[model samples]
Target: MRLVTFNILHGRSLRDGQVDTGRLAEAIRRLDPDILALQEVDRAQERSHHADLTDVAAAAMGAVDQRFVPALAGTPGAAWVPAADPDDPGTAGYGVSLLSRHPATAWRVLRLPRIPFRVPRTGPHRWPQRLAPEEPRVAVAGRFATPEGPLTAVSTHLSFVPGWGQLQLLALRRALAAVDGPVVLLGDLNLRGRQPERLTGYRPLGRRPTMPAGRPDHQIDHILLRGELGPVRLVDNPEMELSDHRPLVVELGARRG
Candidate 1:
C-alpha cells in the first residue's frame, strides 16, 4: 500500500502565496496515495475561500473515507477570537486530516498537551511569528480493513517548541498503544532522526528531509510503522511544489502468508 504524509501549509503554494484548490488537487493526484495524512489543513477559512480543505483533498484523491480533527477553532496566525457562527461556511479552523481509499471502520481524535504559554522565540525564526494565543493540538487515528488485516493510521501535527514536541510525542505513543493491529503513524513531527523510534518504539520508514521544500535539510515529516510488514521504499517526487514542506510517500508491501 502507498501511504503519504504531508503538511500542506494550509494548501498555499510557496510560488504564489495563495491557496489554489485546483493546484492542491493536482498535486495530490500526482502522489496517488492509498492513505494520506495531512497537517495544517484549513476548514471553512476565508484565506482558503471558506473551502473545506480536507473535503477538497478527499474529493481530489477520490478517497473512500476521510476524517478531519480541528486543533484550533479559529484561523491560525490570527487573533484568538471565537467564530461568530460555528456552523458558518466562513468560520475558520486549523487542524489535521486523514484520507483513505479503503473505508475506515473506526476512528478517534487524541488531544495532546499544549504549552500553557507561548515562548517569544519558538518556531522557525525565519518567518514572522504571531503573538496571538494558539489553539490546542491533536492527533487523529483511523482503522481500515486491508488485505493484510486491520491497519491503524494516525495523523498529527506536533508542537514546534523545543522539548515540547517530545512531550506530545509521548502522549501520542500512549494513545496509539490501545489500538488493535498494526499501526502506521504519519505526520510533521517537528522532531527528526531516531528520536521517534526511541520515544514511541516505532521504526521510521524514510529518512528524507521534507521541510523548506525547495532546499530541505531536516527530516521532520515521517511515516513510522509498528508490527510486522514487508520492506518499505520511499517514493521521491522532488517536483511537488504545493507546500513549504515536501510530501513524503512510502510503499508498504503486504504481509506474506
Candidate 2:
C-alpha cells in the first residue's frame, strides 16, 4: 500500500508565507496515499483560519477515516501559546494525525512525558515559566482494518533537544510494544541520519535526507514497518515545497512467510 509521512509545518507553504489549505490539499491529491501520518498539524489555530486540518486533509484526499492527537493546546486566535488544556487535546497548537481510506477499528493518543531537567540558564529564552513544565510530546496511534487484517499506524513528533529526544524515543518504543499486530511508525523523529542502534525494533527505509527541504541533509522524518514486508520503496515528493521538511512516501506489500 502507499503510505505517506509528512511534516506540513502546520500547512504553511514555503512558496508563500501563508497557511494555504488548498496547497495542502493539492499535495495530498498528488501523492494519492492510502495511509497518511502528518506532523505540525493545527486543529483550531486562528492562523489556520481555525480550520480543522485533519478534516480538511481527509476531504482533500477523499479519505473516510481519520484521527488527530494534539501534543499541546493553543488559544482560539493565539498559536503562540504553549499551554496544554488537560480538558482538550484539540486546542493544542501542535499535533499528529492519522488518515486512512479504510475504516479505523480503534484509535488512541499516546502521551510521552519529558525527561526532568532544566534548560541551560545561560542562553536568551522566552517566558520564565515556559521552561519549567515538562516538554510536551505525544503520539497518535490507530488500528485500521484492511482487507488482509487489522494494521496499526502511529504518528508522533519527538523533541529536538539532545538526550531529551532519546528519552522520548525510548518511551515511543515502549508504547509500540503494546501493539500485537502489523504496524507502521511515522513522524518527525528529530533524529539526524546517523544510525538506528540508538532506537530499537525497526529499521528506516532509505538514507535520503529530509530536513531543511532545500538541502535535506538529514533523514529525521521516517516510516518504519513491523512485519517482514516485501521490498520497501521511499518516495520523495520534492515538488511540494510546503514545509521546511520534505514529505516521505513508503510502499509496502505483503511478504511470504
Candidate 3:
C-alpha cells in the first residue's frame, strides 16, 4: 500500500505564487496514495477560491472516506478562532485532513497544544531571529477496514517551537492510548529524526528531506509506525509544483499472509 504525508501549504504553488485547484488535484493524483495525510489545508477561504481542498484530494485519489479537522475557525493568517470541534468542516479555517480509500469504522479529531504568543527563533533561511506566532495545531484520526485488517491512522501538524513540539507530541501520544491497534502517524511533524521515534516509541517507517521544495535538506515530513507491519518497500519524496515542502511517499511490502 502507498502511504503519503504532505504539507500542501494551502495548495499555493511557490512556482507561480498562486492557488490553483487543478494544479493541486493533479499533484495528489500522482501520488495515488491509499492513505493520505495533508497539513495546511484551506476550506472555504478566498485565498484558495473557496475550495474544499479535502474534497479535492479525495476526488483526486478516489477516496470514499475522509475528514477535515480544523485547528482554528476562520481564515488563517488573519481573523480566526481556535476551533474546538474536530468534525467541523463548514467554518472557514485551515488545518489538516486525512483521506482513505477504505471505509472508516471509527473517527477522531484532536486538538494539539500550541504556543499562544509570539516566540523568537532562528529560521533556516529566515531572519536571524524573528518573532512568529504559531496557529493552533490539530489532528485527525480514522480506523479503517483494510484488506490487511483494521488499521488506525492519525495525521497532525505540530508546533514549530523548539521544545514545545515534543511536548505536544507527548500529549498526542497520551490522547491516542485508547486506539485499538498500532497507529501509523502521518504529517509534517516539525520534529525531525529520532525525536519523534524516541518520544512516541514508534519507529519511523520511512524518511526523506521534504522542506523547501526547491532544495530540501531537512526532513520534517514523516510516516511512523507504532506496531508491526510489513517491511518498507520504498520511501521517496516526489517533487511537486505546489507548497514549500514536497510530498513523502512510502510503499509497504504487504500486511501478512
Candidate 1 clashing pairs?
A: none
Q: How many pairs of residues collide in model 3?
A: 0
> Which 10 residues in a row give candidate 3 its minimum summed lDDT?
82-91
Query: Where does candidate 2 have its weakest 10-residue lDDT segment?
Result: 120-129
Per-model TM-score versus the true fold: 0.91, 0.85, 0.94
- What's the lDDT for residue 35 in model 2? 88
Q: lDDT of each model, Cα atoms only?
A: 0.83, 0.76, 0.88
Give residue 119's lDDT in candidate 2 (0 to 100).
Answer: 53
- Cα lDDT tens digits for candidate 3, 1-257: 88999999999998789999999999999999999999999999999999999999999999989998888888875688888753465678889999999999999888877787887756567775666567888889999888778899999999888898898899989998877776899999898778999999888988789887999988889898988777799999989979999999998888676
| Model 1 lDDT per residue over 221-246, tens place | 98999886667755563547589899
Instruction: Count clashing pairs, candidate 2.
Output: 4
- Residue range with the least summed lDDT across 10 consecutive positions in model 1: 80-89
Model 2 segments more than 4 A misplaced: 75-93, 115-135, 194-197
> What digit string (tens of lDDT, one per residue) describes model 2 on residues 1-257?
77888899888977777998888898888888888999888887877888888888899888889887777676422334343535364454667889999899888778886756755322345334344444478888889988657889888888777776678778878878878877788888888764343485676665567787877777888887676545665556465748888888877666545
